[model samples]
Target: MAQVKLSAAGERFFGTNVTPRSFEQWIAFLRLELKKTQRKRITASHNLHSIYLRHNNPDMAEFYARADDCFIDGMPVRRLFELFSSNAGFNHRFTLMDNLPQFLMAAQREKWRIYYLGSTEHVAQKSLERIRREYPNLDMHLHHGYIKDNAAVVDNINKHSPDILLLGMGMPLQERWLLENFEQLEFGWVVQAGATLDYFTGEQAKPPRWLSAAGLGWLYRLAHDPRRLARRYLFEPWWLIAPIYRHWRLQRQENGTPRT
Candidate 1:
């Protein structure tokens, strides 16, 4: 397969390179990539947890560094990019939940095969059922994330040979799985789809438009599952302070400005 060339230029945030693409541009990029036969490509998204992981976890850092394309999925990340990046264009947060429907519709039209791997078996079943009802013509496949044999799962995926692979096994796990088996995977695009299936299945409540637009979606998620997210939302960000400060100083130096 010929390499599909696409321009996704951007500045580095902390240690991760992020492409500040608008929702439309992101969709367009995906469409173009899907149209071509190319080597395995993985799309990664960033948020506070991901940023923190990049700083602390070597495996996570390597995954981000090797990602084919990265986007801002968190409002805080988008805000930081606006503060740090000098180049100006649309810098929107591209969450899978917000964009999955449109992309799936496009997949339907294009006859692209999609394989989603994540969520509980129940949630996965529900999501598949919903997709069947809504998009009967769309070629979609699903497998729950709890797998005993990684190789067998890889074999199953290869058998399907999907055009797009939606991996939603959650942070480091999803990232780690791809990093480990990237060479074995046969797909045009591997999307980091964290918790998107849950949202799609209505297992998790979707935040209101105003809250998501106002950048308080984290707060809403925290309110819903405080025990699971308290540390991530409240304490993990504190760990990022030192790295963010160092990045700020480096940015200042690069721009020939005195560090305040």
Candidate 2:
């Protein structure tokens, strides 16, 4: 388990060590994993700033910390790391949109099959159409996110044995599902992609580059889905204050300086 040991700043911002890899590097790693001869699994996940800010939920924090590979999915988290973690080389934040095309291209070139699992049945179908329209050469499969039988899902996945599984079933749910079924699943790469399917299906519109760069994408999302995201953006993020201070104290101690 490679832990990102940049410093307490990295930990405080992410609740764990986030692998500070750029989009190209991340795709390269996935390509290498696809080429590997082993039948083992390769897991990758992304965490939003809300994950680190969720101080009240120890389980969530621990899950993020223990993910085999974690990337920054929220621009705010990346911006915060850039501001506070001077030693961290995390200048760019790569969302599902940034990585999906590259991944699909790699999968196409290598003739790797893909299984997309997420979104409603309708949205999943729409996404399938979109993928076919855009990436006509890409071989892919699909499963809706409204899963009722966990064992059945596992069995189905094992039966198909796709090279990569891109799961868009939100955060903690996807993480927990992978934790329970990963050992039995037969995918080379399992990527937790949150609402990527929604974006693909045009159910959720992509935020403008300016808004995303300014770290206001959450606010834009909140403006759209207030009922669902108000608490996450407005209240949950307040929990980050405690960890930010704690990180500062640790830095002071490491520098052998007295706290003023």
On lDDT, the leading prediction is: 1
Expressed as tens digits, the lDDT of each residue in 1-260 for candidate 2 is 33322312233344555555666656666666678776545355434443553455554555655555566667766665665565556555677754576677767877888888887999889878877888888889888889998788788877878888888787667766776676788887777777887765668866776887677777778888889888778776677666666766766676732121
The sequence of per-residue lDDT tens digits that candidate 1 reaches over residues 4-90 is: 334357566666667877666777688787777675887888889999988778889898888878888888988887778766554
TM-score of 2: 0.82
Best by TM-score: 1
Tell me the alpha-carbon RMSD of every candidate. Answer: 3.9, 5.2
Candidate 1 lands at a TM-score of 0.92
